[model samples]
Target: MEPASETPTALLLIDIQKGFEHPTHWGTSRSTPSLETNVASLLSAARSYNESASQPILIIHVHHHSTSPSSLLHPSARLPGTETSAIEAADFAAPTGTEPVLTKNVNSSFIGTDLEARLRGFGAGQLVVAGLTTDHCVSTTVRMAANLHVLGDAPDGEGIFMVKDATATYSKGGFDAETVHAVHLASLDGEFAQVVSTDDILGRVFR
Candidate 1:
């Protein structure tokens, strides 16, 4: 299951921050109990592939920071003393210094960021996306990535993939989090992106 593009591919991690992990603040059940472990595994594989690949695999980290002080995601709301928003180090598979970190204020990473241009600049024709909130930020970013016309080509299915096991969202209203996660995965599969497990990605796509 190698990606369709011969050009370099990127591992795009979206919104894997600490604020989302707070059960009291975020209030969501995960699709998998091993979400952090799976994400770490996939990230390790991506790093290994990047080191060996001649085409240069880029690892990009996308995080969300609330622009408004009133927003729950605002650093002031989460940690009073910290002026900067940070990825939750306890849970995050930390990125190397060479990897670029992109911050976004909106659900779609591309809306206020240069992520699309940066990917194109790196000659990345395909992307594997993994991160928090399967039905929100992760889903939104994957859809935008799928729609991107890289190298003068039309939007295609090969452009992006969603790592199912590596992402989780909180349950909302009466719907369970697992159900929400599954429904979004189903919607994206065969359309915006291929929904795949971390093992599938590591064994097939990254290998």
Candidate 2:
């Protein structure tokens, strides 16, 4: 998070919410056990970069708030009497100070939210993405970030850097958690994002 880097590559953390903690709903286990630690590392570097530079680094948090009251993500479902939503960002990834938080109901963070507009407003052309459920929100956001022209119409996700170790997903169908995670990353690699790792991004961020 040092050096007079170029226009800062914004970090987008999506759907890192409490409801995903339900193993039954997601899976018995998740793909990456180090997901929290990896994302926290990226977050720390982003904060340092923001604080050290005049041009602030944008570290945005996007949470999913399910539309249905029965859904685990909805406040009525998880909090019950308290009515507090499970949409609260995980402790390590929560927004602090001036960082922005966007609540979304769909897989893509850009849909039904001001995410794209915010990125545009901040002039954030490059983005480093990480989050829960690698195949869902994280993958969708990365694809839309390219297809929707949010990151300047790069067909091959030129501006989107998807951090592999920082993202995770659960098993579905007949597949296992690790298999699900690997397949999604492979699918999103060349077509939707430049699949990267925490150390790889940190090196570039600190460059």
Candidate 3:
């Protein structure tokens, strides 16, 4: 479907699936308890970003379908009649009619999916990305979006937007989840993305 915004910015939600919904899935620990809620709010704000505009902001869901049989995200791992499945999108961020749902096995959404083409098709020059794992898939997609120059080449993920509170990550090494999350945001801010909060995005980008 065509974008409903004059500016035509795309909201790219990466790996916002049931697989990583709870901390138990990721060693039972994660940083942001409000990640899903923040993203949901973002989605709502983006959809109604410009109510009077002819077109609204385009929405794209990037799902991670793991090819590895042992991985939870793999299709086979999601058994029938289960309470939740790894591949299913979270309730708050599920795609609606006509919204594009791009699946990928790798971290970067642009790697093997038609995400780039879809963005180009929708004529969304700017991208606002939010989803799972600040240092993993989210980081990879942001870096790729900057390097790919979809929003023009200035390097250091200048044109793209990354929601700080809307993304989360698990603890690893000697660090805690909070530190890991903070560090990733700091690393990506300016260097890989704008890294703004959900409220900030709603106020600025949508406005």
Candidate 4:
């Protein structure tokens, strides 16, 4: 989907999966309550602004699921009927039909998914990303969004906006949540996209 407006914006909810509940990925390092609470807040904010026809709030949810044998989160790794494979219950409770969920395997939401098409269809130019593990899928997707012009040969412009408070990261590659979150946000803000909080963004949507 293309940006609906001259400066159209949308929100991308990335990888708020139930698999993170396991002590291995999120529980041990990132913690569930921290990630879940922030995401819930962002969802509520996005939903409220979207209600008004004047304010175009497009919400696209991105879920991560892997089928690769080498994948760290293969289905076999998870217990049957766990929230890991399905969309979290909280997400379903979002204002009905407002959020459409997209499942992906690669870190970048644009990879092997119709995300670009959906964004273009919705006419969304700027994207706000919020969800689990800021250093991995969220970080990768932001980088891709910022650099998409490379493929299309368009002039440089603000491509993505990340909600800092709404994002969470795990301890990975020798970096803990504090270090990873800070470094990634610094690189993303200005360079890749604007970084804002759920409250600040909520104000814009409502006002």
Candidate 5:
């Protein structure tokens, strides 16, 4: 196993927001198990590794926000008197001081956000990515990872590493789940990112 600090890896947890409770976020009308279990397991595994690792894991949680009128994700939206937004507290379980959250309006975490700068600040060369909608935010972030240059002038760019089981997508969307899931993995594997699993990742860290 590579030394943790020397490895320069970070976990990219994207769009785990509570607003996804409805299908509107996925261009649908209802939610599915994708929002509940798969991503939850990944988060648990990540937190476990963080607790035991010699070097603390750097977690960058990406939240989606919108300014568009009538959009549920609009910046003016709220869940009542609470300061918590759906993106703020939903499906969130980060060890205090370990995960720094980044809010974004775009699908790609690198686009219109401080994600790239924050990743470099944490010295992350490899990214372990997980989150909602296999066809959307998760996929977009992975794509951006492949082209993200450490410095625009640098020859080689930092690559994206995707955790397959760590991600989930709603089943009732306009697209078919089996086909959409398979295609995303196939397209991402090798060309843009390396598709992996939660166990595959934990094995590297634990043993």
Candidate 6:
């Protein structure tokens, strides 16, 4: 994956939380059965690449926290396996000290967080985005990332590469999850970002 420039790149993981994994609470019908596995593999490769590369990759996690007490994702609500809005253990490995987790309440990770500033601070002009609900948080954040102008005059000129297989969405309103996932990817492809697979990311971008 050739970057737009030599600027540092970051792997932005969005809303890969346990709250979305609770079958009974969140319902079934996912875009891919191997979504978590693919995400974990990508995360591992990104971390490894950061360690060995001359320009380290910044790994940032965007976590969602609902404020309403009745919401399933409310921080106080407990899932079957975890007590908080923690990253899903089944699909994601534990994060290290170097990685920072940014919390947000809305769909876009950039809305209430310093993510844009942080990316600029790290000198990251390219973003590798992956996460849950391909049609929701993933799509919103990517669009914002592509349009973000940290320097004030023009858009930050960031290049966003989305991992297709590493993201999943739930079936909704009689539509299948797979179709929803594909439609969203199609909409984003060649527009907000380039949609690619985990294998493509590992082989081309991570190296």
Every model's TM-score: 0.87, 0.91, 0.89, 0.78, 0.77, 0.88
Model 5 stretches astray by more than 4 angstroms: 1-6, 23-35, 78-84, 92-97, 150-159, 171-174
The whole-model C-alpha lDDT of candidate 3 against the native structure comes to 0.80
How many times do residue backbones clash in model 6?
1
RMSD (Cα, Å) for all candidates, in order, is 2.8, 2.5, 3.3, 4.1, 4.0, 2.9
- List model 5 lDDT by residue over 1-207, tens digit each: 243445766777887766655544555432234434655665676667677777666777887887674555666665545555655546454434657778788778888888888877776656778877677888888777776663233233234557777676654436666557667878888867778766676767323
Candidate 6, residue 182: CA error in Å?
Answer: 0.7
Give the higher-TM-score candidate: 2 or 5.
Answer: 2
TM-score pick, better of 5 and 6: 6
Scored against the true structure, residue 68 in model 5 reaches a CA lDDT of 77
C-alpha RMSD between model 1 and the true structure: 2.8
**TM-score of predicted structure 3:** 0.89
How many pairs collide in each candidate, listed in order? 1, 0, 4, 15, 0, 1
| Per-residue lDDT of candidate 4, residues 1-62 (tens digit) | 13323356777888776555556545347623455666777677656655664647677887
Residue 146, candidate 2: Cα error in Å is 0.8
Report lDDT (Cα) of residue 117, candidate 2: 88
Per-residue CA lDDT of model 1 for 1-207, tens digit only, reads: 464235567888888776665564566465667789988987887777777676766788887888877665665555434544444433555677888888788899998889988888887766888888788899888877777654237356565778888888877877888898889899999878878888877776676
Better of 2 and 4 by lDDT: 2
Stretches of candidate 2 above 4 Å error? Answer: 1-4, 79-84, 153-155
Best model per TM-score: 2
TM-score of 2: 0.91
Please provide the root mean square deviation of candidate 4 (C-alpha atoms, Å).
Answer: 4.1
